[model samples]
Target: MTSLALGPATPAATPRAATPPHAATPSGAAVPVTPAAAATRRPSEGSVHSWDLSTGVDGPGTRFVTFLSGCPLTCLYCHNPDTWRMRNGRRTSAASVIAEAGKYVRFISASGGGATVSGGEPLLQPVFTGELLHRMKHELGLHTALDTSGFLGVRATDALLRDTDLVLLDIKSWDPDTYEKVTGRPLRPTLDFARRLADLGQEVHVRFVLVPGLTDDPADVEGVAAFAGGLGNVSRVDILPFHKLGEAKWQALAMPFALHDTPSPTPERIAEVREVFRAHGLNAV
Candidate 1:
């Protein structure tokens, strides 16, 4: 419980490159480690795809964002396909990642930002996620946000939420069948997570991508608006226009790229979808 809408920023992309060969930092703490630094440094257990210091679009302000690996969902629009499997990236320790984040903490805190642990799916490594969030809040004295599909919200422990200040929950589709088709995952878990988060009074931001042929239905958008409106903790809603920016990633992976020809939704269509949320008294951007 405690999920949806962390903030309405676009979550724009910078495709992650393959992890480079590693050499230690002279401290001998393993140049590459695993995250959640949750337990003993079990090298290779927790992993990360990549991390970058970014601004204006991920969370509230500038942030040190880490993208993890091993996702249950296979969304067609996912640009971080390289993060689909944990093995694709190097094992990293939470301490190491946080230390790297420490470099930008001052700048981030100055602008009211913190850290975001995004994914292939953060919930896939709950312990690591919980520990990472805990440290970001307590040790670093910074805000913490979790960006997720809410698909694995069940994995989030109370300890994890205690460390989390916001949740960026992406609701891929409102209709169950369509949601399944879109994400290759069930929709119930996300809805369940959203409800629990609201009940817990946790802050959340709902995000939806407006895909022309797939999710442009008036009923579908309206359905999402209705559900999000019912959640008292939702602070805002982001309307992301679908794009083919990830086509190359798919091609490189040799996976089918059916959406290559799928055009982004028209401005009018996007406006219409935003209106559905607005009509439901949501702050759709």
Candidate 2:
């Protein structure tokens, strides 16, 4: 596909050198803390968890995004393939993560934002994501969100939705065969999870990656719109433009780039798809 820019802006690199050690502030907190304070405070081990922090970009307010490790389905276009392996990531405790996340609570509150747990399929690490959200809300009083494909059977439970303030659910495709082709899995479970979440009256923002020749199909778009339209708890729909941002990552990891030759979707096409969702009364953004 055409060039993609996923995640946040990459920071400038610093040359490694022998120098004095210093403490670091938690990335994307609502407020900045002194280095001295960070150094004096014991870093919470947070279960040695594996998470890539994104300071903003995926919820109602300012957010500290976490890329939790592990996923059940192997979506061919997944950008973060490295997170698919559970054992490959760190295993930090919830307490430690909250302690570190707490350093940013002031920033979150001031900015009207909080933390988001995204993943290779965060529900794959339900206990971890749940525990972290629980602590963030109870201990730190911060809003919590979850970004998930909602494909796992046992992982889509009511308990998981309880701690979550918002659910960014990805609907890969409406057609089962096309979904299998794209994600190497079935579609029923994912759809079921969405409806179940909605039935429970949990707030949800439905997301669909606008992939040309795949998810852009009128039938697929219409199906998604119809399903979402019927949901009582679905508050909005987000149309994500597809891109090939992770092509280099594939090369770096010695993995094949499935969409290496695919072209990016045109602006006209994205607009047309947005019109479809708007027609269905689903707020498309």
Candidate with the greatest lDDT versus the true structure: 1
Q: Which ten residues in a row have the lowest lDDT in candidate 1?
A: 1-10
Q: What is the C-alpha lDDT of each candidate?
A: 0.78, 0.70
Per-prediction TM-score, please?
0.84, 0.80
Expressed as tens digits, the lDDT of each residue in 22-113 for candidate 1 is 21232322233343332344322357777776764467887778778889999988877878997876676666666667777888899888
Q: Candidate 2 on 1-285: residue-level lDDT in tens?
A: 121123321222222211112222233112223566555654222222244334433676666666666778777778778777775456555554565567667866887878778777776765556666666766679888888887863464454466689988899888999999988888998888887787788898998888887788899989998888888787889898888887787788899988888778899998998898888788897
Deviation in Å, model 1, residue 163 alpha carbon: 0.8
lDDT of 2 at 260: 82
How many times do residue backbones clash in model 2? Answer: 16
**Candidate 2 ranges with C-alpha deviation above 4 Å:** 1-57
Q: Candidate 2, after superposition: displacement of residue 60 in Å?
A: 1.6
Query: What overall lDDT, based on C-alpha atoms, would model 2 receive against the true structure?
Result: 0.70
**Predicted model with the maximum TM-score:** 1
Whole-model lDDT for model 1 versus the true structure?
0.78
